[model samples]
Target: MPHSHQNRIQAPQLAAVVVACIALFTDMLVYGILIPLLPLMPAVSRSGPAATGLLFAAYAGMMIIVTPLAGRFVDRRGPRGPLLAALLGLGMACLLFAVGGPYWLLLVSRLLQGAAAGLGWVASLALIAAAIPLPKRGTYLGIAMSMVSLGTLAGPPLAGWLAREYGHAAPFVFATVVLLIDGALRIAFVRPVPPQADDPATALDVLRVKGAWPVVILIAVGSGVTSMIEPILPVQLHEALGLDSVQIGLLFGLLVIVAATLNPLVGAALGRCSPRFLVFCGVLLAMAGLLLLGGGARHAPVIAGVVILGAAIAFLVAPASTLIGVVGARTSPPALGGAYSLYNLAYAAGLV
Candidate 1:
């Protein structure tokens, strides 16, 4: 290929990666921002914690349904339209969250956000696969996952400070502004690559690939174990160790910090090692961490478990998608979108 042609290809791929990272960041940021604000909101507070839990469930539930459909849509229509639509939906959801009327309105906002999440994730991952070469997929996916981890780490503290100093609506407004800028950037620079004609494998065909089912199972089990910890850990700390809210917060923060710090390293490793080996090691580490958590009545053991579990999560998460992408690439007819959709679906189901 000519130098100019190479530049053209690389430019779009780079833009696609950037767009995917930003989209994933925005999705996680909005999600994390809601954690603190929901309990404090007047409409939500009156309904109690169960309602708030339901709100979270609503998002995951929609994601479980929408992701596979979004993947199929991307396969048929390319990612640009669904990506743009998701951004638009996310913007609207943010606007609704900021406005804050009835409790039902909040539910509506969450539902929209879930749809956006589903579309955004499916489109973004599919776009990444389409844009980047197979060997580099893990590295770029790691970068994208790192952005998500950072968002999760940053969003709650930022939301709490904003809500404390400003008002309940302030964080959502901030999110709205950031999302608008992100959407504008997408519109301006992120052009979609056409779906490859060679990738004719349907979702069912993708599922039949030898290694794919095991990868999906691993994703689900890993995600389920990780998700279980997030809600249960603070309670365990408060009751078992008599830690105050601030201490609990710091501990959770440490977990995210460890995971975020290690994400890029794990991602880089995925490029060099067999993903299956990394995943197997990760599962073993996770089991050990869980054992520690179960037995650790004291502080040191608990902290050790937390650190080990965080590392396990990083190992599991960074490689699972890469492995799926790799398998899809090797298929008789590559089914990148379908393979990714199943992975996303499994992860979302695990979260719920």
Candidate 2:
């Protein structure tokens, strides 16, 4: 019995979660790192805002089409194979970005990278849900999202520093190296499992589970509200407070740090509190934070608002993810892939 217990403790589950975390962290890191480097790319520099706007559109466009497909594929197959493939695709995208490109190739790179990101999000969440039991997914998913926030926090600054010190290609080269390591980790940690028996069930089937739509909507709201903040905050802070880049970065930096710290706690909180209660609390906090930012004349309120907003996000994301996993696990034969693919769509819809 003790030996059996040891086997359970040493099961590949946590390794799977670790791989998922690494994949997400790397995906977001490269994504964050690219922000500073893109404008410096020859094609973007020549074309300016129009080209930059196109790249943004291209990423959203690809996510709309690719993320759901990736999720569906994961349902038919399994997370291991798809996760590795997505990492490889992400590496290639980094390579393309690293080498610099004509406008068209950069667009292709954005599209490929977006698709790979979609794949990574789906596969990682599915991987975690697959490896973790129902009661524990909340905490793990929270930890996973924390890594995401951390990636975003680190990406732009790191890219800026690297570019200033080394060259334009340095950021991508660094990202490529990281992806290779993530890929290798995937190979070692994610055991090759044969595909599951084909489920006739579609994504719709997963949604049909009672109360699924509410959680899905929560996901969309959680993702959308958070995303809608990114583009607007810098401009708002600049105009309202006359803050420079460093000040604005500091504000967002605080937000990310707070969110990262709170995410795991919210997940762990699930054992005691309900998802609805947590989300309700998140909504209230979001409204309060927005009010603080919108009306504040001084630094303290703005800073307070950012931190509160970060906490709100932690409350929103962890519960919604845990609920999604719960419902996804309910489907006959358990189509976590389909469930999380729908999650991708909600997330993308929110993002776009």
Candidate 3:
């Protein structure tokens, strides 16, 4: 399009995007990587359902507690310290996964990982918001989302394969090594962004900002709409179509693949389209998908619903996020961090 827009991704901005992508990818990667490997572990399997459930709670609970605080921290101090913490937290969690045997150790690892994930998401988004031109942030954020989708799509099967080929520790070892590279890139490419907030002291202050609540609600509903389906889609397919676990997993993978493929394109469209219009279209699509998801008794319709919903989510998430970034950036950079912290909380709430 415009030469000015093309020139937006200068070295620091490019590095910002790169590090953000890797940070998000690693955060999500750690999340997905353990999915298959954990159940296969004798200790984990023997731990029973209560303990297994607690394992997930460890991460999600910590994420919920830390997200808003991390947002405030990033806004005040900039993304530098939070980014470093992400690296260290993720690294240590991976190390524990690789070597530590007891359930307590694994539980602690999840806690560390959950906290790190909160830091990574807030810091990385703030980093890009600060580094990239406002006009281009949507597109770059979409690219980061695409990387996150890759981590989600790849993590389960990759870990399963690695564990099968080598041992239970293989996937964790690989993740630890990936974190090392992530560390190097962080040191080399992460530029410090000065704090920009003038009045907002906490994420709560973000509520006082005009035009912020709608974006926050949109993020939560848009994310929740898709996420709430994750557990249901598999079960619905199984009961209605008699699909096996493998087939259901693959069907769900289609949802991830569709969203992953479309997110960047949707993100780019934000530069040219009204964020409001894009979000409206996304809502319409989501409604249609929900109908199909609810009405369908046949396999084809359900599968189609999954694909459509995936695209609907891509459309919904990108524009809303871009708008929120705009809102956060209206005055100072700290607001941006606060906004994304709200984003993380909203996303986490959706997961719950």
Candidate 4:
């Protein structure tokens, strides 16, 4: 790297990367911590499938309302302020679960958490786009994705062990502490970068841009395919395929591992290619996975489908964010925030 380029990269930017990675990790960890424990929830286990589905919906419902607003807040106020506030909210939300609060409390915490999550994710992405040069953005995004993948991969086993040894609440406590620490580090190390967009108010206007809609469609479909697996896998494996929890865990773990390992390489490759091509290939791969999943085959087929899906995610997510960044470059900071917020909304919606 040239001296000027090296000089442009400061400790704060590096810290922003670390903070974003850790924030992503903690977010995934907190969310996945409940997976092993959810079956233990009285409502989930005893209630009918319809009721249980409602409970799940209740938890995720807030994301729908909070994401776009978070982006606007980041655009107007900058990342450092909102990021810290969001992290603190996440920490408190996790702590609420740790104390074994009532279902109502959990519901409230989840809603608050959805807002925090939207802001945290948007802020982190915005920070990355502002701190890193465009040419290197894909690689950084890949690294960020892998960090999140690693967290999701690691969270289950850790939470499972905690639940088994200590109790369900133990994992929540751990998540709270991790999030707090992450927040503190972010506060200490990260500085707000100048806004990247020209106008937040008009950023949504870009939705009319002929090219942007394809990216949105791509995000929605890709996210939906990924979301489908989480709900179906355990039942399909246990009921249809006759695998035990241990086996299911191993297979799922492998998917995260593979995805994490591949994401950076995929991102670097994306840097060398057009975002559109990479995203298209990602969709094709995910579609293949979905086909295998719905085909109702044995364990091998299931695992194959999962691997493909993970690979598709590894390919698609960073490029999608990159596309948003590209689109926002012509707009104002608030518009940039709106664009990212829209991306998060698409992602969260897809997950639903």
| lDDT (C-alpha, whole model) for all candidates | 0.77, 0.76, 0.74, 0.69
The reply for model 4, stretches above 4 Å from the true place, is 1-7, 55-60, 99-103, 129-142, 191-206, 235-248, 261-288, 291-298, 312-322, 325-339
lDDT tens digits, residue span 35-126, model 1: 55664467865776577667767888998888878877887788888889999989899889987758899999988999999999988877
Candidate 1, residue 123: the lDDT equals 85
Could you tell me the lDDT of residue 265 within candidate 2?
Answer: 92
Worst 10 residues of 4 by lDDT: 329-338
Alpha carbon deviation, residue 123, candidate 2 (Å): 3.2
Candidate 2's displacement at residue 109, Å, is 2.8
- Model 4 Cα lDDT, one tens digit per residue, 1-352: 5955754756767788888888877887776665445544554445544544454455455666766676677767777887887888888888776765565666666667776777778778777766766556546765776676777787766776776678768788888778768877987877867765434343366565557777777677766665556545655666688764445556667767766677667657876898778888887998897788778568778888878888888677757666765665544332454565567777777766
TM-score of every prediction relative to native:
0.79, 0.76, 0.73, 0.79
Q: Encode model 2's per-residue lDDT on 1-352: one tens digit a residue.
A: 8655543524578888889998989988987776546655668667765567677657767878877787677766778877887888888888888778898888899899888888788778777766765446556876787787778888866776677678878889999889889988998888754333433355678998988899888888877666555545555665678775445655666777887788779989999998779999999999999898878778889999989998998899878877787787788767665666677777777666
- 242: Cα error in model 1, Å: 10
Candidate 3 residue pairs in backbone clash = none
Q: Count the backbone clashes (under 3 Å) in each candidate.
A: 0, 0, 0, 9
Which residue ranges in model 2 land beyond 4 Å of their true spot? 1-15, 35-54, 75-81, 96-106, 126-146, 188-191, 195-202, 232-250, 265-281, 287-302, 329-338
Candidate 1: clashing pairs of residues: none
Ranking by TM-score: 1, 4, 2, 3
